[model samples]
Target: MKSGDMFEAEPGSANRQEINPLLKLALELGPLMIFFFANARGERIAAAFPFLQDLGGPLFLATAAFMVATAIALAVSWVMTRKLPIMPLVSGAVVLVFGGLTLWLQDETFIKVKPTIVNGLFAAILLGGLLFGRSLLAYVFDSAFRLTAEGWKKLTLAWGVFFVFLAILNEIIWRNFSTDFWVAFKVWGIMPITFIFTLAMVPIITRHNLGDDSPQDP
Candidate 1:
C-alpha cells in the first residue's frame, strides 16, 4: 500500500469535510497538553479521583489521561470530518497501546518509549515510500499547498530524516532523564522544535510552489 494511503485522508472525496486549521491544531495539541498537565499535577488529580493512585505514579496517571484524551480527540475528529487523519490515528493507536501497557504492568517504560516508536514508524513509512518512487508527503500537504514532484521528494526526505532524529532524541532523553524532565521535554521542547522546523521549510515551499494560476510542471 502507498504511504499516503496509510497516513493521509483518501484523495478526491467529494464529501470530505475540510477542518479549520486552528481547530485542527487544537485537536492535535489538546491531548498532549492534557497529558502534560496531568503529569505535572498528578498528586492533585489523584487526590480528587482517589482511584488513580492505584495506577502507580505521575507518569502512569499521565499515560491514562493521555489515552483518554487521545480517544476523545480522535472521536471528535471523526464526528466532525467523518474520517480520521492517518498520522493522528496511528499516533493515537500507539498512545492507547502503550498507555494501557503502562497501566497494566505498572511500568512507566512503555509510555516513555511511545514517541520513539511512533516517530520511527513514520520515518520508515516516508523513506520506504521514496524507495518506491512515491512522494507520499504530497498527499499529507496537498490541501494546504501544492508543490512540484521534485519538491515533494525533497520535502519528504527532509521530514523522514527529521522523524528519525526525533526518534533518537526521544530514546536518549527518556533513557537518561527523570520522568518529570522527560515529560516536560516531550510537551515543551518537541513542539517548539517542530514549529521552528516547519518555519524553516518556508523557503522550500515557496521555491517549489505551483502557483494559483500556474499548472504543475510536466
Candidate 2:
C-alpha cells in the first residue's frame, strides 16, 4: 500500500533470479523522493518549464513526475526480473490511473488522496483474503522470510489494520492541512514511521519464525 512495499522477485523454484536489494530499494523509493522534491520546488520548476504551469499547480506537476517515475521503476523491474512483482505492479497501476485523472481534471485533490486509496485497497485485499481463509500477506512476503501459518495470519491482520490506519491518517492530513505540509509529511514523515513500525515487528517476526535455529541469509 505504501510506497515502501517493495516487492521481491518470485519465490525461487526454478530459474527465477533474485533482484539486488539496492536496486529494489531504488525502484521503490526513488519515485517518491522525486515527487517530494518536485513538490517542494514546484514553483521554481514551473518557472523554469513554463509548460508545467498549464498543469494547474505544483502538486499537479509533482503528480505528473510521480507517474513517470513509477512507470520507469516498473519498467526497470521488468527488465531486471523478466517478471512484474504483483504488489508494486498493483501500486503502479493505481498511480497511473489516479495520476492521469489528476492531470486530466486539473484537480490536485485526486493525486493528494492517492495514498488513501492505495492503503485502503491493500487493507481490503488482506481482509478479504482472510475471509476466504487465505493469508495473502504470506504470498507477498514469503520470499523474504518464512513463518508459521498462524504467524502469517497474525501478520496479515496486523498489516491490514495498520493499512486502514494509514488511509485514515492520509485523509486527515491532506484534507485538513496545506499541500506543503502534506508533502513534507509524505517525504519526511511516513517512511520513518513505517521503518520504526517494521523494526518493532522484529519481535513478532522472531516469535513466528518457522525455521531452524541455524543462522541463515536473509
Candidate 3:
C-alpha cells in the first residue's frame, strides 16, 4: 500500500464491484432518517411503550436509536457489498464515541456536537494531507470518479476547506439554537447544502475529467 495509492480494492474485484450509487446514498442516509423519525415519534412511541421513554429525553432516545440504526445499516451494507466505506467508518466511530458520551453522561451536548467534531476531523485530515503534498480524498472517491491527479488534488483541497466550513457552521448552529432546532438542522439542513455544493463541483469535475471515463457531460 503506497502512500498515494488510494484504491483499496481493484476494480471488478470482489471488494470493488460497483455499488449502486442510490443504495450507497441510502446507506449513508438511513441512520439519520431513523434518528429524525425516532425523535418525531419519540413521545408517542414512549407513551405506547414507556420503557423506551426512560432512555432519557427525546434526543437521547433518538441518539441511541440513531446509533443502533447506523450499526444496522453498516452491517447490511457489508452484507450486501462486503466492502466498508472508509469515510462512513470514520463517522460511525465518532457517532459511537460521542453517542456514548451523550448516554453515559446523560447529556445531549456530546451528541449535539458530534457532527462538528467529525467534520473537524475530516477537515484536518484532508487539509493536512494537502500540506504534505498528498490527496487522501482520492481513496474514498475512487469508487466514484477517475480524475487526473491534478483534479484529485484540487478537489481534495476544496473538500478539505469545505469540511472545515461545515464544522464551523455546526458549531454556530448548536451553540446558538435549541436542541430540537439543531437536530432538525442536522438532519434536514446539511443535506441540501451538501447536495448543492456537490453540484457546484460539476464544472470542476468536468474540466478535470478523464474523458470517456468521466460522467456523461450534460
Using lDDT, give the best candidate's number: 1
Identify the candidate with maximal TM-score.
1
Candidate 1 Cα misplacement greater than 4 A, ranges: 1-8, 11-16, 214-218
Tens digit of per-residue lDDT, candidate 1, span 65-103:
899989998888877876778778889999999899999
Error of 1 at 48 (Å): 1.4
Q: Which lDDT values do the candidates have, in the order given?
A: 0.84, 0.82, 0.81
- The local distance difference test score of model 3 is 0.81
lDDT of 1 at 120: 93
Task: Give the per-residue lDDT of model 2 (tens digit) for 1-218.
Answer: 44433444333334445578778889989999999999888999999999789887788889999999999999998778666777677789899999999999988888888999989999999889899987778656665777777777888888899889889999999999998999999878899988887787778788988785533222
Angstrom error at residue 203, model 1: 1.0
| TM-scores vs. true structure, each candidate | 0.90, 0.87, 0.88
Model 2 misplaced regions, further than 4 Å: 1-12, 212-218
lDDT of 3 at 104: 88
User: Each candidate: RMSD to true structure?
Assistant: 3.1, 4.9, 4.1
Better lDDT candidate (1, 2): 1
- CA deviation > 4 Å runs, candidate 3: 1-15, 213-218
**Alpha carbon lDDT of residue 115, candidate 2?**
94
